[model samples]
Target: MVRAENLIVKAKCFIPIPPNPKNILSLKSTITSLMVDKGFEPENPTISGPTAGDAGVYYTFTACTTDPEGDNVRYQFDWGDGSVTTGWYASGTEVSLSHSWSSSGGYVVRVRARDVYGAWSGWSGLVVVIGEACPYVYAWNGSAYVLDNNVLVESEVSNGSDVEDFYKLEQAMAPYYAGDHFSVYSIMLGEFENEHSFIDMVRLYAVDHDSSVKIALTPDGQILTYSNPNPPVSAVDNYGYDWLSSLSEIDEIYYQGFPGDYLLLDFGSLDVSQAAKLVLRANLEWKKETCIHVQTLNETGEWEDAAILRTRNRWSTIIVDLADYLPNPEGTVKIRLYMTGVHKIDFVGLDTTVEQEYTITEATLFYAEHSESGKVTLKLLKSDDKYAELLPGEQIRLYFILPNKPADKNRSFIIQIEGHYYAIQ
Candidate 1:
């Protein structure tokens, strides 16, 4: 028999040469035949799924492929976020997979198939666009709605009750791209107040205007489109000797007092028609513990004590709520400070402590639309289930459960909600 080395050399020299020497097409066919004899790859995969979806929400996608040689096949997926499937699936099978994007953007999902011989086919890709989980938020920039990328609404705390120590939060909500209107589907509880805290009621309000507006809301739920914290239009004393003492807080030039001394202050025309609460503030001191009676002129032309101040020897500031005694058809409010025992007054003044500027009635659902002509029009809106359109320069307020007692100060919380914007043509 021939030597084994000679047989191996002869086998290596036997190449698959085409019968037609100058036929390029035949040569190509011969090469293709040799490749097929080794192994045939699977066909490229076809991907099918939703091309658009919300971020952080999962969606289903399907991929399918067939092998050219009818051999068993496997598939691998590229998720397009620098991630890929670690496992492979059977060939010629319609595989379904669910995936979610953590953020909003555009992504490309790709898949490829491989036969039993490990020959991978060309990759097939599908494009997907992910929208924000929350609605597109916009803020009224005094004229038009501008895109608000932050998608957060914030506010500062105010004293809820005039006498009791309680707090209320107020904020101006940004308008969302609802095309026309929107509805509150549900509220998703996130990092809000403490476990002990809860919302009592939710009040919704809206206003329509083509220009900017300066608006504020009081703790008692009154809307204010006018001036606030208005100081006494004029301050005067009974004696007229120390007229400016109550207006300015100066120690040396203060109004020295006797038992029956009184100071009168006049706060010019005020619109208390929609008044919720009014408060009076004064700066007083006493040589001995004394009493100062805060009196307001009622409609019957009689002076009544709205609040009483039991003073200590040192100078102290006092606030008296005067909600009940402030209705005057003439629109003028007069305050009198009657003293008992020895007392010294550094400053005496009157201010409107009504923090809320507007009120939205839950029953009738009234919204105040302010016109440039200093006119306010009451517009009726739908109930809590439905919300009115929020135009530019308008505002929206959310009411929560009032606290029973004062909690720790400087603490923080977050509020989250879920809703859908409608596109109405």
Candidate 2:
């Protein structure tokens, strides 16, 4: 028992006990009176910066205090803007704190601190916060907002996966489509780069029946030329439908002259705002003895034979330059056909014809000065013929044949006749 009492005395010597509760109370009261005299509060309070608008700025405050018996101190802040914070500091020095607001508006921020004895100081002066405004962005898909420039523009997707689709330039110029029939508009934005501005939401519509028609937009939001295929089909046989199957079964040969059939192609009424080159292509499958001839009505109202193509057991394509045949063309452009040998015609495709316009200068036809004996070389010189001369800087078309062909068949051949020289240009 004596040894234990000794141990207790040694422990007391190592860790000293705090002052008596009554003594501590008296000291705290004295310190509180001193703080009151110094215009300091024992309870630390707070004030905050402004709460709203574009004046992006904010702030907090700090207070000072001390006790007769010095003790570690702390701080607390209440930004009247609905935010509160706390910190620790030395007994009687000034404490500073700050914050930034994201918009242009006023906010009140306040700060306060406390001592180790649960004594808080009164809040300091209020700090004001300000903010500034910024720009917004938007985007559109066929229907609802798919993406904004600020957001990711997702690919056309359905059933939890990306689906293939095509976009038409016509849709991009909506409401305006009625006035401008062939006017093209951009279908996608940021195709060139991911940078976009001034938009809210991008609308997108799902392509249900034909997924192939949805097109992707270029970086510049331009419509791409190679669009997905969703070709239209006809309900009847006369519309080139079933034409392919009809030519597949050919068992018997008709000895007598076969029935001749023809098709009339209508170009329809279209307003071409600018000069363009148009090419019309026709694909057909016929028998060995089948011969196809294409004729067009010129601006003079005269039907001219454009091309004559002969084919066997394969598919053949015929191309015609509409600019050469149709003039400020209005109404239906008819394609009259002549068929012999009981051959079947299948699959005819028509494209909107584009015409290419060019100028032809006058030229002269002259004979070559240097020539080998026995060799008759005739050169085409620049004559007064408006369609004959090769212009100095212009590219001209030329056609040539050996000395044994028919001149009548070679009537309209292209040739570039420069000064003292005749060559195919």
Candidate 3:
């Protein structure tokens, strides 16, 4: 009994042995030490990728860190650019983030991680967010027409006789006259008549040819009629007084004709006293079996040598520059048109039925250049004779007289020139 009581008292008195110092400080110090060991080699580091400059494009980065003792880890990411968010993911081995750079240049990202022991891993490598370059584009607006520089002289349509109806006359004569507008048409009689009767009537109509007359045929081919809407009745009937009266439905005839078809263009009236250029717009028609000759008429009414134009079908505009054709700088010049083949003709006015003739007195040589094949230059000796406004690629004829040859045949030494005028710098 004495020993049990005494033992308890002695145990209490003896181990006033100070209780072991609390381990709280040691535990805290341990955690702090582990955290200090968790620092990344490149503290607060980041890795980035390439992007386009000034354009909002994607940038990727990685956060790297390590713990001294292989421990369960968690990561926190800060793009460092300007976004703010913090979190821990279940599969938390590495921390990754994405961001876009607004401008062109290098940028830095920051990342940090912690271990389950409250040990913070240092930052990762400093990643550079690189920017890419961009390019520029230009734009414009308008319309333009282009023609090939190659020339085809006196060329015939490949299939002129096969599809003559659909072939265009202008296209067939393109080698001779390539212009913007042209005229073409056809004429038919109700019934075939004697050549004498037809030729007589045609000559009569030629007297006051200035007047426009309508010619038509009955569907049954029994009657032909002619009418002059703006008639001095005498002018219309003068040729065949009883010719029209014998026909049926004379009033229904319409005079829809082309100017180029029946009449020769008389450019002689054009005033070139102050013009720099003269442009003639004419319409022409062609048929597969016939040929049309274009010639100039002198004051004496004599026709010059003609330029034969042939076609299978279609209408085309024929342009003639009168600069070289005029006998004098200020006088009347005439153009003669003759049909030798089976082709027909017609004429139409621009904007109106009344034809207009423009006079040019002052002309400008828009362009004048030559190649080395022995240059033939036409210098402007008189500004008053200006007929030079012709565009590049226009056509012309150069009349040269060879020595010791008859004047008539010598003049035949005509050289056709294609339009390829160049402007002098």
User: lDDT tens digits, residues 64-179, model 1?
Assistant: 88876577766777877754553555557788788898855446688887665456788887656565211222223333333332111111111221111111111233322212
Q: Write the per-residue lDDT of candidate 3 for residues 219-330, one digit (tens) a residue.
A: 1111111222111111122122222222112232222122233234433244433221222122223233335555555556676643554422222222223335553423
Instruction: Locate the minimum summed-lDDT window of 10 residues in model 3.
Output: 197-206
TM-score of 2: 0.21
Q: Cα lDDT of model 1 overall?
A: 0.44
Among all windows of ten consecutive residues in candidate 2, which has the lowest summed lDDT? 410-419
Distance from true position, residue 281, model 3, in Å? 7.0
* Total backbone collisions, model 2: 85
Q: Which stretches of candidate 3 lie over 4 Å from their true place?
A: 1-262, 273-290, 298-301, 327-330, 344-425
Best by lDDT: 1
TM-score of each: 0.28, 0.21, 0.21
Query: What lDDT does each candidate get?
Result: 0.44, 0.32, 0.29
Clashes of each: 16, 85, 38
Q: Count residue pairs with overlapping backbones in model 1.
A: 16
